[model samples]
Target: MNRLRTLLFSILFYGLSVPIVLSVPVSALFGRAAVVRHAHVWALMHRMLYRRVMGIRVRVEGVVPPGTYFFAAKHQAMFETLELQLLLGGPAMVIKRELSKLPFWGWAAMQYGGIVADREASAGALRSMMREAKALKAEGRSILIYPEGTRVSPGEQPPLQSGFAGLYRALGMPVIPVALDTGIVWPKQGAKRPGVVTIRLGEVIPAGLPREHIEARVHAAINTLDRG
Candidate 1:
């Protein structure tokens, strides 16, 4: 039954995404605001589909303060990607360069103001990321990044990628560490389970902290939702 539900939801999700993705070019004709508005609508649709079809509810435990701050979140499942878009009102995301190279979706992401960085490039990637991040900051938009770099199953504690610390120090903004257990209900590769996914926002870690201190705080804060 769960498998059937997952399959049905996946079909509807992607089926709907096709027209939305195709409309990216048309959306761009109207300008960036149009593109962003379309993206937000897409995220909201995914949230509705997840709730109605899969019975997965997303609950926020802590306050998500307003303003142009950095959002460091746990990467446990694809669910958070959509959830954050709705949660933060279309904050700019730091995504892989490869994703930006795709067809329609890639172009739409760029048009919608996503920052793409090459993870394999190490220091060079951080430099590129910092430059793009600064631009987003100038626009008064929040920056969303997964410090661990990739999705990890719940209960796993992977050290944050070095680039995260670099970006944090260079960006010079408060960091809001978001912890979540989305993997419990929405595993990376499996049937979606029906449950409440809690997203807890930790206290803001102010700017100018030492690299070690900031990294430590973010690492711990983002894992608070993981069950032992």
Candidate 2:
């Protein structure tokens, strides 16, 4: 019965996401106010979907800093992207190319200030991302990114990818390490399990740190949560 419910809800969730994303332009034409409202509305809907369909509750810790600092969070579940802004305000994400292929979601994500990347297009992608990140920072938007590049399985830990270190070095931005235990509840590719997921915010790793140091600190912070 649980499986049936989850499957049904999952189907509905993905089915609706497409149209929602594609309607961004139409939603914007209604006016700027409408677009802002739509983003907030969708954030709420995203929370509801995860709670109802995925059976996962989020427990956040520590205070989210003000202004634009890069958020280096652990990636372990599909819900990470959706629930990013739940408690943290003004936070937009750096997402991968696969998300952009989903018809409606891709559009909506773009509209709501997400930074999408085409991993295959290395040089071009980095240039574009750096430009956007700087511009968005000036506009007071926090940038959230999963430094690991891909979701880690429940029993496995993936090394933090180099892109994050490169971004920090290039952007010269402070980074907040967010530790989360999401795999237990929202497994990378499996049935959702009912559980409470805790996301703990660590100390700020200031900018200008050496590349090797930045990589090590970020990796340690994420691994701390994975073990806890």
Candidate 3:
């Protein structure tokens, strides 16, 4: 049954994640890049588990651009969080500051060079996020951000949060809008179904566009992957 498969996969996935998460501190000793490479391995392992245990397949469409760029993606389920690190070759993630305050995982994420945002801080958060993002950009790392700020169901489309536009303008990198229907198979907080999740990469939205234009374009591009 779907429920049985989801439960089994969750147990195995987290069971495997124990050693990977614990090894973060050891990886940090080598440097931030080392920690990032370890994170990529973690993500890859989870992807492999998903395929083997849950019968979920990931199919990517469109071109994934090269070089350091900003990635604006739809937030549907936790699956993409694990997939992006593998797909983007250890790109810097835009995550909540609270998540970075955890135990070992938080320490590793900090060393891995994530751009942490204080969601409740509004404008101040955007400023802080951009500052960190710029530093990561200089290191030639792509930035991955979920513009919706949180997971939404597969068919619902929401306007991007304010931080996305701010980062796009301040970072001055081409924005790669990505859309995926992971929620159709992996619901936010329930049993996952067996299916192929398609991730579609939209054409690069050139930098220097007006705020409204950028938001509109990304919003539409991401929703294009929705099933309904």
Off by over 4 Å in 1: none
lDDT of 2 by residue, 28-102 (tens): 888544554676666677778778876768888888777668889888876776676756664767878788667
Model 1, span 1-79: residue lDDT tens = 8899899999999999999889888889998778888988888889889999999887898887777788999989888
- Best first by lDDT, ranked: 3, 1, 2
RMSD of each: 1.2, 2.6, 1.2
C-alpha local distance difference test of each model: 0.87, 0.75, 0.88
lDDT, candidate 2, equals 0.75
Span of ten consecutive residues with least summed lDDT in model 3: 117-126
TM-score of each predicted structure versus truth: 0.96, 0.86, 0.96
Residue 82 accuracy (lDDT) in model 1: 82
Model 3 per-residue lDDT tens digits across residues 83-187? 988887778999988899998778778889878987785777778889999999998889999998888997888778888888998999999899999988988
Stretches of candidate 3 off by over 4 Å are: none
State the TM-score for model 1: 0.96
